[model samples]
Target: MATPATTAATSAVSVRLDALIAQRLAARALVLAASRKVAADSSGIKTSRFRGRGVDYVESRAYQPGDDIRSMDWRVTARTGRPHTKVFQEERERSVLFVLDHNPSMQFGTRVRFKSVQAARAAALIAWSAVRGGDRVGAVGFGGGVTGEVRPAGGPRGALRCLRSFVEWDALARATQTASPLSEALERTRRLARPGSLVIVATDGFCADAAAQAPLTRLATHCDIKVLMLTDALELAAPPRGRYTFAIGGERRRFEFGDGAHDGAWVEAFRRRRATFVDAARKLGIAVLPVDTRDELARSLALLGLALAARRGAA
Candidate 1:
C-alpha cells in the first residue's frame, strides 16, 4: 500500500521523482501478473511476441531446400536421419523508447491525478516492465521548446535515468515560456528509434494533427509504435449544464454551459477531435491507448498487456 505522502506526491501536477521510483515494485508486480495471464490465455504462444532478432533459440525443424546452410543442425540431423536447420526467435533484448510530452496542456486534471503525473507514472511502469523483460529502456522528453534524451541502456540504470529526466523536464516545462511542437519530438524519435524497437509516446492529444501524423506514420514502418493519449474527464465530457468559473495560471476564466445548445456543442467538439486522432492512428496501423486521469495506472497498463497478448495470439 502506498502512504499518504506517496499518494500525494504522485497525485501532484509536478510529480516527485521519488514517488515514480517507489512505484517500481508495484509496477513489477503488475507486469508479472499480466504476463502470467497472457501466457495462460495464449497457451502455445510466447509471451514476448514483439518481433526482434535476439539470441534465444526456439526450435529446429527438417531443413528445406532453400534453408540456409549456416543454420544447419548437425546433431539433430544425425539423430533424426534428416537434414535439420536451427530456428531462433528474434533477440529479446528489444529497445523500449519512451517519447514523453510535458507541455503546458498536460498540467490539467479534474480527477484522481494530473494528466502530466499520470503520463509520468505510465512511462515509469513501461520502463520497469521493459527492464524486467530483458530489454533496454530509454526516453525522450520534450516541452518548453527543449528536448531531453536518455540513450537506451540495459538494466535498471536506463529506467532510473529516464525517471529522473522526466521529473526535471516536468519542472522545466512549468517554468519555461517557450512551446515545442510535438511533431519535432516525433521527428527526433524517428532518428533515435532503430528498427524493431518499441516506441511508446505518452502525451495529451494536442499533437495528433496532420503535421504530427506523418512522422509517427514513418516511425511505425520499422518500429513497434504505441501511443498513450493522456486525457482528463473534463476533456472527454462536459461538466453539468451550468456556468462555471475557474482559475488558470493566476487568472480567472468563466464558461457558460447552462444552455443546452452550448453544452451539446462542447461535447460534440471534444468527441470530434478525439475521433480524428483515433481515426488517424488507426489508418497508420498504430495502437493508441487512451489513458484517463481517473483510472489506475497499473490497471490500465495491465489491460494494455492483455490487448497485446490478444493481438499476438491472433497473429
Candidate 2:
C-alpha cells in the first residue's frame, strides 16, 4: 500500500465537503435504521456492523434458522445436545453525541484538509444516520474543556444543528486560544454523556497520561465511547526530509534530512508511536479509528459499518 507521501498528494480536493451537508452515502440504509427506532422494529436485519461498533454478548442458546454458526460457543455446543451459539445485539437506537476537539493542533494538516475537516465529515455522517434512523443527535465542541453542547433532538433539523456544531469546532477552538487538556476532556465526557448513547470523540493523539482513560470507562458505564484519532498524512509517511526549520512555542529548531545511513528511521519511529497509541486504546476496549484526510472517510466508514453489522448479525 502506498503511504500518504507516495499516493494522492496531488489528488484534486476540488470537492468541498460542505461541512453543512451529509454526503448521503448509504442514505437508504441509514434512513431505514431511523425508521425502526422504536416498537422493536427489527429490520429482521442485523447491522452487518460486527467490528465492535456496538455489541453486548448474550449467552449461547441452541442454534436456530438463519443463525450464523461462526458465533457458536464450542464449549456450550459440546455440553448441549443441540448446536448452541452466542447471540449479540447492536445496543439499539439512541442519541449519539459527538465530542469534537478542535484545539490549535487539529487545524494543521499535511494533506487536503485539517484534522478538524476530517472530524466534521465523520461526525456529519453519524448525524445523518441518526437523523435517518429517527434518533436524536447532539454535539459537544471543546478545546481545553467543554465549550458548547447542542442538545440532542430528532429529525433533519436536529441533524443540521449537529453538523453546524461540528463545523464550528475549529472556530470555537480558535476563539478560545487555549491548548486542549486531556484529563479535563475525560471529566467532561463523564459529566455530559447519558446512559445508553453513543459518544464519539475526535482529537489529536497528544494525550498526557494513560490514566486519563478512566473517564472513558466511566462513560462506558452509561454510553459507548468510540474514539477517532486524527493525524496528518505527513505524520504517517515521512517525506524526503528536505531541510526544514520551524518555531514551536517560541523555541526555534533546525533539523536535517536523512543522512543516507538513517533513511526512513524517523518514519519507523512515528509508525511505532501511532501503533502504540492504537493498541493502548484497544486494550481499554475502546474502538479507535484513525483519520488522516477527509477523502478516506467514506471507504473507512463503509468498511467499519459493514464489519460491525456482520458481527451483529453473526452474533
Give each model's whole-structure lDDT. Answer: 0.78, 0.64
Q: All predictions: root-mean-square deviation over Cα?
A: 7.2, 10.4
What are the per-residue Cα lDDT tens digits for candidate 2 across 1-315? 868654444222211235347455655464444333421434564444332223467677788887766677889877876788787654555677887876666667767776767777777776776666556788877773337788888888888887766655555565665775665666876776666577888776654346666766677666767888887776766567587776777798876776754547756765664564466568768888777774556556654444333323344
| lDDT (tens digit, per residue) of candidate 1 on 1-315 | 999987685557677788789778877787677767876877875544542233456788889897778678899999999999887676546788999887777877888888888898888887877786677888898876548998888888888998899888888887884556777898999888876688988987675566787887888777888889888888877798778998877899999876778878877876775675577778888888889988777787887655443443443
Best by TM-score: 1
